[model samples]
Target chain A: MNMSRIVRSTANILFPFILVFGFYIIVHGHLTPGGGFQGGAVAATGFVLLLVAFSPDIIRDKFSFNSMKYTEALGLLLFIITAFVAIALGTTFFFNWLANGGIIFGESVAFGANPGILNSAGTIPLMNVAVGIEVIGAMGLIIMYMLSGIEGGNKE
Target chain B: MKSKEILTAIIIAVLAASLLLPSALMVFGSPQNDGMDSYMIDNGQDIAAVNNIVTGVVFDFRGFDTLGEALVLFTAVLGVTLMFRRMKEDEEYEYE
Candidate 1:
Protein backbone atom coordinates (compact mmCIF):
# COMPACT_ATOMS: atom_id res chain seq x y z
CA MET A 1 0.00 0.00 0.00
CA ASN A 2 1.22 3.48 -0.86
CA MET A 3 1.76 5.78 2.10
CA SER A 4 -0.63 8.74 2.35
CA ARG A 5 0.44 12.16 1.09
CA ILE A 6 0.87 13.45 4.63
CA VAL A 7 3.26 10.65 5.50
CA ARG A 8 5.28 11.19 2.32
CA SER A 9 5.49 14.91 2.93
CA THR A 10 6.64 14.39 6.52
CA ALA A 11 9.23 11.90 5.40
CA ASN A 12 10.56 14.29 2.78
CA ILE A 13 10.74 17.07 5.32
CA LEU A 14 12.65 14.96 7.86
CA PHE A 15 15.05 13.23 5.45
CA PRO A 16 17.65 15.98 4.95
CA PHE A 17 17.68 16.96 8.58
CA ILE A 18 18.34 13.39 9.64
CA LEU A 19 21.13 13.07 7.09
CA VAL A 20 22.82 16.21 8.36
CA PHE A 21 22.61 15.06 11.95
CA GLY A 22 24.01 11.67 11.05
CA PHE A 23 26.90 13.15 9.11
CA TYR A 24 27.66 15.47 11.98
CA ILE A 25 27.85 12.49 14.24
CA ILE A 26 30.24 10.77 11.82
CA VAL A 27 32.58 13.67 11.11
CA HIS A 28 32.77 14.75 14.74
CA GLY A 29 33.00 11.19 15.97
CA HIS A 30 36.50 11.56 17.43
CA LEU A 31 35.30 14.44 19.62
CA THR A 32 31.69 13.55 20.23
CA PRO A 33 29.43 10.98 21.81
CA GLY A 34 28.42 9.29 18.59
CA GLY A 35 30.64 7.52 16.08
CA GLY A 36 30.49 5.78 12.72
CA PHE A 37 28.18 2.90 13.60
CA GLN A 38 25.79 5.13 15.52
CA GLY A 39 25.78 7.78 12.80
CA GLY A 40 25.34 5.23 10.05
CA ALA A 41 22.39 3.70 11.85
CA VAL A 42 20.90 7.15 12.22
CA ALA A 43 21.34 7.82 8.50
CA ALA A 44 19.78 4.47 7.66
CA THR A 45 16.74 5.50 9.68
CA GLY A 46 16.14 8.25 7.12
CA PHE A 47 16.33 5.77 4.29
CA VAL A 48 13.94 3.56 6.18
CA LEU A 49 11.57 6.47 6.51
CA LEU A 50 11.68 6.97 2.76
CA LEU A 51 11.10 3.31 2.18
CA VAL A 52 8.09 3.39 4.44
CA ALA A 53 6.77 6.49 2.70
CA PHE A 54 6.87 4.95 -0.77
CA SER A 55 6.50 1.48 -2.19
CA PRO A 56 9.56 -0.75 -2.17
CA ASP A 57 10.01 -0.64 -5.94
CA ILE A 58 9.93 3.16 -6.01
CA ILE A 59 12.52 3.49 -3.26
CA ARG A 60 14.60 0.60 -4.61
CA ASP A 61 15.10 2.55 -7.86
CA LYS A 62 16.83 5.30 -5.86
CA PHE A 63 18.96 2.88 -3.82
CA SER A 64 19.58 -0.17 -5.94
CA PHE A 65 21.09 -3.39 -4.60
CA ASN A 66 24.10 -3.17 -6.92
CA SER A 67 24.83 0.42 -5.94
CA MET A 68 24.62 -0.45 -2.25
CA LYS A 69 26.88 -3.46 -2.74
CA TYR A 70 29.44 -1.30 -4.48
CA THR A 71 29.18 1.33 -1.79
CA GLU A 72 29.88 -1.27 0.89
CA ALA A 73 32.93 -2.52 -0.99
CA LEU A 74 34.25 0.99 -1.51
CA GLY A 75 33.81 1.92 2.13
CA LEU A 76 35.58 -1.21 3.32
CA LEU A 77 38.37 -0.59 0.86
CA LEU A 78 38.79 2.91 2.18
CA PHE A 79 39.00 1.58 5.72
CA ILE A 80 41.59 -1.02 4.79
CA ILE A 81 43.66 1.44 2.81
CA THR A 82 43.63 4.00 5.59
CA ALA A 83 44.80 1.34 8.03
CA PHE A 84 47.56 0.11 5.76
CA VAL A 85 48.80 3.56 4.74
CA ALA A 86 50.51 3.88 8.12
CA ILE A 87 52.48 0.72 7.37
CA ALA A 88 53.44 2.08 3.95
CA LEU A 89 54.84 5.11 5.80
CA GLY A 90 57.08 2.74 7.84
CA THR A 91 54.89 2.26 10.89
CA THR A 92 52.91 -0.69 12.24
CA PHE A 93 49.36 -1.43 11.18
CA PHE A 94 46.76 0.96 12.62
CA PHE A 95 49.50 3.19 13.95
CA ASN A 96 48.76 6.84 14.54
CA TRP A 97 51.70 7.95 12.45
CA LEU A 98 50.18 11.21 11.31
CA ALA A 99 49.85 12.63 14.82
CA ASN A 100 52.09 15.65 15.45
CA GLY A 101 53.58 15.21 11.94
CA GLY A 102 52.43 18.66 10.71
CA ILE A 103 50.47 17.18 7.79
CA ILE A 104 46.77 16.83 7.05
CA PHE A 105 44.95 15.89 10.25
CA GLY A 106 48.28 15.96 12.02
CA GLU A 107 47.69 18.44 14.85
CA SER A 108 48.74 17.05 18.20
CA VAL A 109 45.93 17.58 20.70
CA ALA A 110 46.48 19.48 23.95
CA PHE A 111 46.81 17.52 27.20
CA GLY A 112 43.34 18.27 28.49
CA ALA A 113 39.91 19.52 27.56
CA ASN A 114 39.65 22.53 25.32
CA PRO A 115 37.81 23.60 22.17
CA GLY A 116 38.36 20.86 19.60
CA ILE A 117 39.37 21.73 16.07
CA LEU A 118 37.85 19.91 13.09
CA ASN A 119 41.24 19.21 11.56
CA SER A 120 42.46 17.19 14.55
CA ALA A 121 42.64 13.42 15.01
CA GLY A 122 44.97 11.82 12.51
CA THR A 123 43.41 8.78 10.75
CA ILE A 124 40.67 8.36 13.37
CA PRO A 125 38.27 10.66 11.58
CA LEU A 126 39.06 8.99 8.28
CA MET A 127 38.33 5.62 9.84
CA ASN A 128 35.13 7.03 11.26
CA VAL A 129 34.00 8.19 7.84
CA ALA A 130 34.96 4.90 6.28
CA VAL A 131 33.13 2.90 8.93
CA GLY A 132 30.17 5.22 8.62
CA ILE A 133 29.88 4.66 4.87
CA GLU A 134 30.34 0.94 5.26
CA VAL A 135 27.64 0.66 7.92
CA ILE A 136 25.22 2.82 5.95
CA GLY A 137 25.68 0.77 2.80
CA ALA A 138 25.50 -2.50 4.70
CA MET A 139 22.31 -1.50 6.53
CA GLY A 140 20.67 -0.11 3.37
CA LEU A 141 21.42 -3.31 1.50
CA ILE A 142 19.77 -5.26 4.31
CA ILE A 143 16.58 -3.19 4.15
CA MET A 144 16.54 -3.39 0.36
CA TYR A 145 16.85 -7.17 0.35
CA MET A 146 14.13 -7.54 2.96
CA LEU A 147 11.83 -5.32 0.91
CA SER A 148 12.61 -7.34 -2.17
CA GLY A 149 11.81 -10.53 -0.37
CA ILE A 150 8.49 -9.11 0.78
CA GLU A 151 7.65 -8.00 -2.74
CA GLY A 152 8.61 -11.43 -4.04
CA GLY A 153 6.40 -13.11 -1.48
CA ASN A 154 3.51 -10.75 -2.16
CA LYS A 155 3.57 -11.19 -5.92
CA GLU A 156 2.75 -14.88 -5.82
CA MET B 1 -0.15 -28.22 40.38
CA LYS B 2 -0.21 -24.52 41.32
CA SER B 3 2.30 -25.15 44.12
CA LYS B 4 4.54 -27.05 41.67
CA GLU B 5 4.41 -24.20 39.18
CA ILE B 6 5.24 -21.70 41.90
CA LEU B 7 8.21 -23.77 42.99
CA THR B 8 9.42 -24.04 39.38
CA ALA B 9 9.17 -20.26 38.95
CA ILE B 10 11.08 -19.65 42.18
CA ILE B 11 13.75 -22.14 41.16
CA ILE B 12 14.14 -20.49 37.75
CA ALA B 13 14.33 -17.04 39.29
CA VAL B 14 17.03 -18.16 41.70
CA LEU B 15 18.93 -19.96 38.92
CA ALA B 16 18.85 -16.92 36.65
CA ALA B 17 19.99 -14.65 39.46
CA SER B 18 22.83 -17.01 40.28
CA LEU B 19 23.90 -17.11 36.64
CA LEU B 20 23.73 -13.39 35.88
CA LEU B 21 24.03 -11.57 39.21
CA PRO B 22 27.81 -11.77 39.61
CA SER B 23 28.35 -10.22 36.19
CA ALA B 24 25.68 -7.57 36.61
CA LEU B 25 26.95 -6.62 40.05
CA MET B 26 30.64 -6.38 39.16
CA VAL B 27 31.89 -2.91 38.29
CA PHE B 28 32.63 -2.56 34.62
CA GLY B 29 36.35 -2.13 33.71
CA SER B 30 37.45 -3.22 37.16
CA PRO B 31 40.16 -5.72 38.40
CA GLN B 32 42.10 -5.43 35.12
CA ASN B 33 41.40 -1.72 35.76
CA ASP B 34 45.07 -0.84 36.08
CA GLY B 35 45.75 -1.91 32.52
CA MET B 36 44.70 -0.57 28.99
CA ASP B 37 41.85 1.79 29.99
CA SER B 38 44.00 4.00 32.20
CA TYR B 39 46.71 4.03 29.59
CA MET B 40 44.24 4.93 26.88
CA ILE B 41 42.65 7.61 29.00
CA ASP B 42 45.95 9.21 30.02
CA ASN B 43 47.71 9.04 26.66
CA GLY B 44 44.93 8.64 24.09
CA GLN B 45 44.77 12.30 23.14
CA ASP B 46 48.51 12.72 22.50
CA ILE B 47 48.73 9.37 20.73
CA ALA B 48 45.57 9.32 18.62
CA ALA B 49 44.79 13.05 18.82
CA VAL B 50 41.15 12.27 19.40
CA ASN B 51 39.34 13.79 22.32
CA ASN B 52 36.96 10.93 22.48
CA ILE B 53 38.96 8.16 24.09
CA VAL B 54 36.34 5.58 23.12
CA THR B 55 36.79 6.40 19.46
CA GLY B 56 40.51 6.22 19.85
CA VAL B 57 40.19 2.81 21.44
CA VAL B 58 37.81 1.52 18.81
CA PHE B 59 39.50 2.94 15.72
CA ASP B 60 43.16 3.02 16.73
CA PHE B 61 43.91 0.85 19.76
CA ARG B 62 41.65 -2.03 18.82
CA GLY B 63 41.32 -1.55 15.08
CA PHE B 64 41.61 -5.22 14.28
CA ASP B 65 38.48 -5.83 16.33
CA THR B 66 36.65 -3.14 14.42
CA LEU B 67 37.72 -4.71 11.15
CA GLY B 68 36.58 -8.08 12.39
CA GLU B 69 33.23 -6.59 13.28
CA ALA B 70 32.94 -5.12 9.80
CA LEU B 71 33.76 -8.49 8.33
CA VAL B 72 31.09 -10.05 10.48
CA LEU B 73 28.49 -7.55 9.31
CA PHE B 74 29.52 -8.09 5.70
CA THR B 75 29.26 -11.85 6.11
CA ALA B 76 25.80 -11.48 7.65
CA VAL B 77 24.64 -9.34 4.74
CA LEU B 78 26.03 -11.86 2.31
CA GLY B 79 24.22 -14.65 4.08
CA VAL B 80 20.91 -12.77 4.02
CA THR B 81 21.18 -11.88 0.33
CA LEU B 82 22.08 -15.45 -0.55
CA MET B 83 19.12 -16.81 1.39
CA PHE B 84 16.71 -14.57 -0.54
CA ARG B 85 18.42 -14.83 -3.93
CA ARG B 86 16.77 -15.56 -7.30
CA MET B 87 13.16 -15.34 -6.23
CA LYS B 88 11.76 -14.09 -9.49
CA GLU B 89 8.67 -11.95 -9.95
CA ASP B 90 5.47 -13.94 -10.49
CA GLU B 91 7.11 -17.10 -9.20
CA GLU B 92 4.80 -19.24 -7.12
CA TYR B 93 5.47 -19.49 -3.40
CA GLU B 94 6.75 -22.96 -2.86
CA TYR B 95 5.46 -24.87 0.13
CA GLU B 96 6.94 -27.85 1.85
Candidate 2:
Protein backbone atom coordinates (compact mmCIF):
# COMPACT_ATOMS: atom_id res chain seq x y z
CA MET A 1 0.00 0.00 0.00
CA ASN A 2 1.05 3.58 -0.56
CA MET A 3 2.37 5.48 2.47
CA SER A 4 -0.68 6.37 4.52
CA ARG A 5 -0.82 9.31 6.90
CA ILE A 6 -2.52 7.14 9.50
CA VAL A 7 0.21 4.51 9.25
CA ARG A 8 2.86 7.20 9.47
CA SER A 9 1.33 8.59 12.65
CA THR A 10 1.01 5.15 14.19
CA ALA A 11 4.61 4.25 13.30
CA ASN A 12 5.94 7.47 14.74
CA ILE A 13 4.36 6.47 18.01
CA LEU A 14 5.61 2.87 17.90
CA PHE A 15 9.15 3.24 16.51
CA PRO A 16 10.88 3.98 19.81
CA PHE A 17 9.48 0.86 21.46
CA ILE A 18 10.56 -1.28 18.51
CA LEU A 19 14.05 0.17 18.67
CA VAL A 20 14.36 -0.51 22.39
CA PHE A 21 13.08 -4.08 22.12
CA GLY A 22 15.48 -4.79 19.25
CA PHE A 23 18.41 -3.52 21.33
CA TYR A 24 17.31 -5.76 24.18
CA ILE A 25 17.32 -8.84 21.95
CA ILE A 26 20.74 -8.08 20.49
CA VAL A 27 22.42 -7.29 23.79
CA HIS A 28 21.01 -10.29 25.62
CA GLY A 29 21.60 -12.57 22.65
CA HIS A 30 24.50 -14.49 24.17
CA LEU A 31 22.48 -15.45 27.22
CA THR A 32 19.60 -16.58 25.03
CA PRO A 33 19.54 -17.82 21.44
CA GLY A 34 19.39 -14.54 19.49
CA GLY A 35 22.52 -12.69 18.39
CA GLY A 36 23.91 -9.91 16.23
CA PHE A 37 22.37 -10.87 12.93
CA GLN A 38 18.92 -11.59 14.27
CA GLY A 39 18.88 -8.55 16.48
CA GLY A 40 20.35 -6.40 13.72
CA ALA A 41 17.59 -7.50 11.41
CA VAL A 42 15.07 -6.68 14.12
CA ALA A 43 16.57 -3.24 14.66
CA ALA A 44 16.60 -2.59 10.94
CA THR A 45 12.92 -3.45 10.88
CA GLY A 46 12.18 -0.38 12.97
CA PHE A 47 13.85 1.84 10.41
CA VAL A 48 12.26 0.00 7.54
CA LEU A 49 8.87 0.46 9.13
CA LEU A 50 9.48 4.17 9.33
CA LEU A 51 10.63 4.37 5.74
CA VAL A 52 7.70 2.40 4.44
CA ALA A 53 5.05 4.15 6.51
CA PHE A 54 6.27 7.71 6.22
CA SER A 55 7.76 9.39 3.20
CA PRO A 56 11.54 8.92 3.20
CA ASP A 57 12.14 12.62 3.51
CA ILE A 58 10.46 12.73 6.90
CA ILE A 59 13.18 10.54 8.39
CA ARG A 60 15.90 11.69 5.98
CA ASP A 61 17.30 14.39 8.27
CA LYS A 62 17.63 11.97 11.18
CA PHE A 63 19.38 9.26 9.18
CA SER A 64 21.73 10.76 6.63
CA PHE A 65 24.02 9.04 4.13
CA ASN A 66 27.17 10.43 5.77
CA SER A 67 26.15 9.09 9.16
CA MET A 68 25.45 5.63 7.75
CA LYS A 69 28.78 5.64 5.85
CA TYR A 70 30.67 6.49 9.02
CA THR A 71 28.85 3.90 11.14
CA GLU A 72 29.24 1.11 8.56
CA ALA A 73 32.96 1.82 8.11
CA LEU A 74 33.40 1.96 11.85
CA GLY A 75 31.55 -1.31 12.29
CA LEU A 76 33.71 -3.11 9.69
CA LEU A 77 36.85 -1.65 11.22
CA LEU A 78 35.75 -2.78 14.65
CA PHE A 79 35.07 -6.32 13.47
CA ILE A 80 38.42 -6.48 11.67
CA ILE A 81 40.26 -5.00 14.61
CA THR A 82 38.68 -7.51 16.96
CA ALA A 83 39.86 -10.34 14.73
CA PHE A 84 43.35 -8.82 14.47
CA VAL A 85 43.60 -8.50 18.24
CA ALA A 86 43.16 -12.24 18.46
CA ILE A 87 46.06 -12.61 16.02
CA ALA A 88 48.12 -10.15 18.08
CA LEU A 89 47.58 -12.22 21.22
CA GLY A 90 49.31 -15.04 19.32
CA THR A 91 46.12 -17.03 18.88
CA THR A 92 44.58 -18.09 15.55
CA PHE A 93 42.34 -15.50 13.91
CA PHE A 94 39.06 -14.82 15.80
CA PHE A 95 40.28 -17.19 18.47
CA ASN A 96 38.09 -15.50 21.11
CA TRP A 97 40.55 -14.81 23.90
CA LEU A 98 37.88 -13.13 26.01
CA ALA A 99 35.87 -16.35 26.50
CA ASN A 100 38.96 -18.35 27.46
CA GLY A 101 39.84 -15.58 29.90
CA GLY A 102 36.28 -15.20 31.30
CA ILE A 103 35.12 -11.62 30.96
CA ILE A 104 31.66 -10.06 31.30
CA PHE A 105 31.07 -6.64 29.75
CA GLY A 106 28.47 -4.27 28.42
CA GLU A 107 25.13 -3.62 30.10
CA SER A 108 22.95 -6.38 31.55
CA VAL A 109 25.82 -8.54 32.79
CA ALA A 110 24.66 -10.71 35.65
CA PHE A 111 26.86 -10.44 38.72
CA GLY A 112 29.19 -13.39 39.48
CA ALA A 113 28.37 -15.19 36.26
CA ASN A 114 30.81 -18.02 35.48
CA PRO A 115 32.33 -19.11 32.23
CA GLY A 116 30.70 -21.87 30.08
CA ILE A 117 27.24 -20.72 31.06
CA LEU A 118 24.85 -19.96 28.22
CA ASN A 119 25.10 -16.31 29.27
CA SER A 120 28.88 -16.13 29.00
CA ALA A 121 29.69 -16.41 25.29
CA GLY A 122 32.77 -14.12 25.66
CA THR A 123 34.01 -12.29 22.59
CA ILE A 124 31.00 -13.49 20.69
CA PRO A 125 28.88 -10.96 22.53
CA LEU A 126 31.12 -8.11 21.47
CA MET A 127 31.25 -9.41 17.95
CA ASN A 128 27.47 -9.54 17.92
CA VAL A 129 27.28 -5.91 18.97
CA ALA A 130 29.73 -4.92 16.28
CA VAL A 131 27.86 -6.86 13.65
CA GLY A 132 24.56 -5.37 14.76
CA ILE A 133 25.94 -1.87 14.39
CA GLU A 134 27.48 -2.62 11.03
CA VAL A 135 24.40 -4.29 9.59
CA ILE A 136 22.01 -1.58 10.72
CA GLY A 137 24.35 1.16 9.59
CA ALA A 138 24.99 -0.36 6.18
CA MET A 139 21.35 -1.09 5.44
CA GLY A 140 20.16 2.21 6.83
CA LEU A 141 22.70 4.10 4.74
CA ILE A 142 21.82 2.25 1.56
CA ILE A 143 18.11 2.85 2.10
CA MET A 144 18.75 6.52 2.80
CA TYR A 145 20.76 6.87 -0.38
CA MET A 146 18.04 5.29 -2.42
CA LEU A 147 15.27 7.29 -0.76
CA SER A 148 17.13 10.59 -0.87
CA GLY A 149 17.03 10.53 -4.64
CA ILE A 150 20.73 11.32 -4.93
CA GLU A 151 22.23 10.72 -8.37
CA GLY A 152 25.29 8.54 -8.98
CA GLY A 153 28.58 10.43 -8.57
CA ASN A 154 26.75 13.56 -7.44
CA LYS A 155 28.76 15.47 -4.84
CA GLU A 156 25.63 16.62 -3.09
CA MET B 1 0.74 -9.95 0.31
CA LYS B 2 -0.74 -12.51 -2.05
CA SER B 3 2.64 -13.28 -3.61
CA LYS B 4 4.11 -13.80 -0.15
CA GLU B 5 1.64 -16.55 0.86
CA ILE B 6 3.88 -19.53 0.20
CA LEU B 7 6.91 -17.93 1.83
CA THR B 8 4.82 -16.89 4.80
CA ALA B 9 3.51 -20.42 5.26
CA ILE B 10 7.06 -21.82 5.25
CA ILE B 11 8.25 -19.18 7.69
CA ILE B 12 5.37 -19.84 10.10
CA ALA B 13 6.05 -23.56 10.10
CA VAL B 14 9.76 -23.06 10.78
CA LEU B 15 9.23 -20.55 13.54
CA ALA B 16 6.61 -22.78 15.17
CA ALA B 17 9.06 -25.67 15.23
CA SER B 18 11.90 -23.56 16.57
CA LEU B 19 9.58 -22.56 19.40
CA LEU B 20 8.30 -26.08 19.99
CA LEU B 21 11.61 -27.97 19.75
CA PRO B 22 13.16 -26.25 22.74
CA SER B 23 10.23 -26.89 25.03
CA ALA B 24 10.01 -30.49 23.87
CA LEU B 25 13.69 -30.93 24.57
CA MET B 26 13.26 -29.44 28.02
CA VAL B 27 10.71 -32.16 28.74
CA PHE B 28 12.58 -35.10 27.14
CA GLY B 29 16.24 -34.07 26.76
CA SER B 30 18.92 -33.15 29.26
CA PRO B 31 19.98 -29.60 29.95
CA GLN B 32 23.31 -30.23 28.22
CA ASN B 33 24.13 -31.77 24.83
CA ASP B 34 20.85 -31.37 23.05
CA GLY B 35 22.65 -32.81 20.01
CA MET B 36 23.87 -29.49 18.57
CA ASP B 37 25.23 -27.98 21.79
CA SER B 38 27.45 -31.00 22.54
CA TYR B 39 28.92 -31.07 19.09
CA MET B 40 29.58 -27.35 19.40
CA ILE B 41 31.31 -27.62 22.80
CA ASP B 42 33.43 -30.50 21.62
CA ASN B 43 34.81 -29.02 18.44
CA GLY B 44 34.30 -25.32 19.14
CA GLN B 45 37.66 -24.60 20.73
CA ASP B 46 39.70 -26.75 18.38
CA ILE B 47 37.82 -25.54 15.32
CA ALA B 48 38.06 -21.95 16.46
CA ALA B 49 38.95 -20.08 19.65
CA VAL B 50 35.56 -18.46 19.91
CA ASN B 51 33.69 -19.99 22.86
CA ASN B 52 30.39 -19.43 21.16
CA ILE B 53 30.15 -22.59 19.09
CA VAL B 54 27.74 -21.10 16.61
CA THR B 55 30.04 -18.14 15.91
CA GLY B 56 33.03 -20.36 15.33
CA VAL B 57 30.98 -22.57 13.07
CA VAL B 58 29.60 -19.65 11.08
CA PHE B 59 32.49 -17.18 10.95
CA ASP B 60 35.67 -19.24 11.31
CA PHE B 61 35.02 -22.92 10.67
CA ARG B 62 32.88 -21.89 7.71
CA GLY B 63 34.47 -18.53 6.94
CA PHE B 64 34.68 -19.01 3.18
CA ASP B 65 30.92 -18.65 2.85
CA THR B 66 30.70 -15.46 4.93
CA LEU B 67 33.24 -13.82 2.64
CA GLY B 68 30.99 -14.60 -0.28
CA GLU B 69 28.03 -13.06 1.56
CA ALA B 70 29.84 -9.79 2.16
CA LEU B 71 30.84 -9.64 -1.50
CA VAL B 72 27.24 -10.25 -2.55
CA LEU B 73 25.98 -7.36 -0.44
CA PHE B 74 28.62 -5.05 -1.93
CA THR B 75 27.64 -6.10 -5.45
CA ALA B 76 23.94 -5.52 -4.78
CA VAL B 77 24.63 -1.96 -3.67
CA LEU B 78 26.73 -1.32 -6.77
CA GLY B 79 24.04 -2.69 -9.07
CA VAL B 80 21.32 -0.59 -7.46
CA THR B 81 23.42 2.54 -7.71
CA LEU B 82 23.94 1.94 -11.43
CA MET B 83 20.29 1.25 -12.10
CA PHE B 84 18.83 4.20 -10.18
CA ARG B 85 21.30 6.99 -10.95
CA ARG B 86 19.12 8.62 -13.57
CA MET B 87 15.93 8.42 -11.50
CA LYS B 88 17.67 10.01 -8.53
CA GLU B 89 18.89 12.87 -10.69
CA ASP B 90 15.42 13.54 -11.97
CA GLU B 91 13.98 13.68 -8.42
CA GLU B 92 16.70 16.11 -7.23
CA TYR B 93 16.10 18.51 -10.12
CA GLU B 94 12.35 18.37 -9.54
CA TYR B 95 12.85 19.32 -5.88
CA GLU B 96 15.03 22.29 -6.83
Winning candidate number (TM-score):
1
Q: Which candidate ranks first by lDDT, i.e. highest? A: 1
> Could you tell me which 10 consecutive residues in candidate 1 chain B have the lowest summed lDDT?
B29-38
The DockQ values of the predictions, listed in order, are 0.56, 0.11
Residue range A1-156, candidate 1, lDDT tens digits: 568999999999999999999999999998889898899889988888887778875775577788889888888899999989989999899887776777988888898897887788888888889989988898888777777766432111
Instruction: Report clash pairs, candidate 2.
Output: none
* Residues forming the 10-long window of minimal summed lDDT in candidate 1 chain A: A147-156
Query: Model-by-model lDDT, in order?
Result: 0.85, 0.63
User: Which runs of model 1 end up more than 4 angstroms from their true locations?
Assistant: A152-156, B1-32, B87-96
Residue ranges of candidate 2 with Cα displaced over 4 Å: A105-119, A149-156, B1-39, B43-56, B59-71, B86-96
TM-score of chain A of each: 0.93, 0.78
Tens-place lDDT per residue, model 2, B46-86, is 43344445665655555445434544554565565565554
